[model samples]
Target: MIEVYTDGAANGDPGPSGAGIFIKKGKNNYHYAYPLGILSNHEAEFFAVIQALELCRKEFPEEILSFRSDSKLVVDVIEKGFTKNQKFLPLLQKIQEEAAHFSFFFIKWIPEKQNFHADKLSKKAIHLNKS
Candidate 1:
């Protein structure tokens, strides 16, 4: 099984943002910090999940995936397999598409404290975007 932890952050409600992904499989691990120009915090969170799903598809397509995120909205929407917000339809669709590639996929919400590593990486990406 592969475990993925993802987080997203924006300096403002609709400001410079970033997505952070941390992947672990057995003893191996991978980390990514990506700058996402300017987006709302919720958008960034959805993007983070999409980015992580793409990474897993590319690197570990056959493995079962367990995804963790600090965003309750993202986790809940994904778990429920639906979203009422029209703006999030595309993002949710992309996430579902990517997740379909895996043998099994699960997403859950974690406290920010438990997701510190990914959160820090996202903040770092935000700082990089400032330059």
Candidate 2:
């Protein structure tokens, strides 16, 4: 199965932000980072998941996906039928809708400390976006 782990960071809740994702399949692994213009941290988290799904669709079209994220809001909305806060409801719904395009997909919640790689990249992404 193709595996993906993602995370996002913001200097402040409504500050400059970024996202990072790590994708792996067997021995192959790849990482991506993106600058997010001013936005909330939660939005960045949502964006990371969106970006990961898009990349997975493009690069691993034939494989099943097992996705993981450290954000509870993201994982719960996607996997557990948790209703998002109204502010996030549309975004969550949109992500869920897009995920349906995948042949197979699953999401699991992970603690922030266990998501080191993604955290590192997201921090780097913040720095990169600054310059």
Note each model's CA RMSD in angstroms. Answer: 1.0, 1.5
Model 1 Cα lDDT, one tens digit per residue, 50-117: 98888888888889999999999999899888998999988999999988887799999999998888
Give the residue spans of candidate 1 off by over 4 A: none
Query: Cα lDDT of model 1 overall?
Result: 0.91
lDDT of each: 0.91, 0.84
lDDT of 2 by residue, 20-120 (tens): 99888899888888888787999889888888887877888777888889998888777765573886777777778768888888889989887888888
Candidate 2 collision pairs: none
